[model samples]
Target: MEMFRGFLFISIAMILFSLNLSNVEGRIHYHKKQKKGSPVEPPTYAPSPDDPVSQSPSYPPPVSQSPSYPPPVSQSPNDPPAVPSNPSDPGNTTSEDCVFDVMAFGAVGDGCTDDSAAFAAAWKEACAVESGVVWAPSNLTFLITSTIFSGPCKPGLVFQVDGVLMPPNGPDNWPKTDSKKQWLVFYRLDDMTLTGSGTIEGNGDQWWELPCKPHRGPNGSTKPGPCDSPAMIRFFMSSNLVVSGLRIQNSPMFHMKFDGCEGVLIEKLSISSPKLSPNTDGIHIENTKSVGIYDSVIANGDDCISIGPGCSNVNIEGVTCGPSHGISIGSLGVHNSQACVSNVTVRNAIIKNSDNGVRIKTWQGGAGSVTGISFENVQMDNVRNCVIIDQYYCSTKACQNETSGVYVTDVSYKNIKGTYDVRNPPIHFACSDTVPCTNITMSEVELLPEEGELVDDPFCWNAYGIQETVTIPPIDCLQDGGPEAIGESGTYGCY
Candidate 1:
């Protein structure tokens, strides 16, 4: 037929060119085995999403999983549990239907039922849930009174409070128009977070047995009229705040007040009262700013962290304070008033059995200025005036020495090791014949004498600074800044 139809078209064109070269060598051996299994080796440490430990540090990832209680006990077993310097800190994060369950808003945990209208209707539905959480469940004991949970909330709200909250059993059930001065306020809030592991209990004996309670009058005297007791948690004009792991005890007067706050973060708190429990004061800051009192434990009756009068950038750490009145920054500008504290910082503290250890009282004529203060790594046991700076602060002993004080400057005392209760003077520093406390600095101060009595000699006046590494009973009464020798025209004379 035409050479057998051209041999069937040359055997079908050599079997279609050998099946197109075996499908092009099987797609070039499947792209050379996917280019030799290319994953491209690019991971060495690769974790930075803001790195809260790129892979494992557990992180602030343990507010629960089993926390039915047990962890607040920290009186410095070397204080190792204060996390949150931003382990994803959104004021200490929380979520899940925005958690608002104070016994589901009927709130009768039963410690005598007054739950303040179910905690003001669960803080008005957790101030409208944005990250809200009003939950207070664990062992349960509610009982509030003299409330006021007002707020401009919904920005990470969280008043967890796991248990007891008692108040209102003293001052004859207190209602005489309620302003006993505070009792759990929290007005005008912002990113708030009053944490858990609860217990508020301010049933302050009968407002500490009234008569204006300075131990009920008689020589530690007080007999004034209203004298308003009560301040067991105040926080007015708040900002991104956080008062953590609370356990605040008997109060009737100052035990956690922070007014006009801003970025506060009092952590791991556990304030108690009665050392004679008079003015209470265990964590009070006024007109606060960038505050951060961390890892706390204050025993109490005034000043276990009180830095009042327009405080600025305050920061205390690993606290563990004492049987009262030790970490104060003021009696500041009282009444002659016009204070202005600045950048205060206390660090790694532990002032046991204290009456005074790192104080800085001011009162005489009171004008402005207490600048950049710092007391570092302090640790005193039998403490009683182990580093003071009075400025003639008189609360009695018939006052009167006014001259225009309060200008302590750049104060610093670092690594203050110690045990001192030789009565007083382990470093006194009177200052202010007219504001004469300038640039004082001490380093590695070691104050011994727990009762082996012999360490006194350190009582400067019109203080003036600089001792770098030899200060146990040897500060030699710091002086040397002149205006004629000390102040007011000098020669040192303000007793």
Candidate 2:
């Protein structure tokens, strides 16, 4: 009976041990299945030393993903780690490229310091990189001297100017070693863009007081000394350029000038100066082609926009001009030189309190042609000489009436509704005696006196065209058929 009891106890112990081993095996198998099927947390990556964000020690920490988000795709041990979209993430790899910050290159953004060297250095770095951005960060002001940002850079470079740019305070501080004709010049660039919510302050009050400036001398005449004033900004020999969203003000001379550029676009600019500022044209383009200037406001002493010699295929629309000389073509063909301008269209413009609206002036002793010009949908308010073509345009009274002149032909005006100042004729066409204007057409042109009754009539001299619709004050002076040559001197070749 004792042996039987001992055997029974041994059997019970064996059964219990067997049940415990089975439970352990099941738990192990369940854990293996979970390891094969469940998503695994991705490993953290360290940023490489060559990373742009890592190069700048002052950059903020990298931003991290939310805890509730799913894990990232698993990376192989041999593959490169993924870069973080947000560089401030502490747990992710951070990287940035091709953003050349001017402040990072030792620019002191105090409004008084000279930051031109720093800007040039930053531009050099940016120009070498493809599609790089040269950033002038916000909430800062940089004082620069006469600078030339020259480039034959890689495609798609951008000058991002979010901060204020100011020149030296007037003419006294202008650098003698630098050029006196340009404050900021861009040269030889292609496929570039200059844009920002920045202000380019010329600080031109003292420069305007120079004796050589117009009306600054005795008896409202210019003095005969050396008179050289710098334009605020100039683009030279560039192509496929864009300039927009800038506020340029108080220039000593022209606010903006473009020379020898093609495929240029300028829009949404605000340009202003005192009405008495001499030679302060808002925009001036010479030898440019395929240009568009739209949606801009300009108030200055000279022409709001001036089309100089060798310009073609220009379109100016949605522009507002006030206290200015209005839009002008020429003062071209000067000094017996040849000039050519064609295919210019100005539409949807407003000219208010200006000296002239839509004028074409050429010198007497010169040759070339101005053709295929159209001015449509223009509204004038208290403007003088609303529409004019003066072949005898001379700044001084000593201009001699030479036999040769720039031929004006194929010009049309439509929907030109306006009020004139009444001191001058609303439409004055004083073409050259030898070379008369031809094919001048007008339609829907209605002009009335701003103050009193219409005292002056529309004047024309040797101008020829057909009036599609009757003008306000009858222009009986215009000849009916094509222009008749006065003599053999009327024929000249335009180069």
Alpha-carbon RMSD to native, per candidate: 19.9, 15.2
Q: lDDT for each of the candidates? A: 0.73, 0.79
Residue-wise lDDT of candidate 1 within 269-368, one digit each (tens)? 7889788778888888887777767777899777888887787767688889888878988888887777787777788889988889889898887777
- The best candidate by lDDT is 2
Runs in model 2 with CA error above 4 Å? 1-96, 486-495
* Candidate 2 residue lDDT tens string, 152-177: 99876777676788888877798889
Candidate 2 residue 129 Cα shift, in angstroms, is 1.3
Worst 10 residues of 2 by lDDT: 83-92
Judging by TM-score against the true structure, name the best candidate.
2
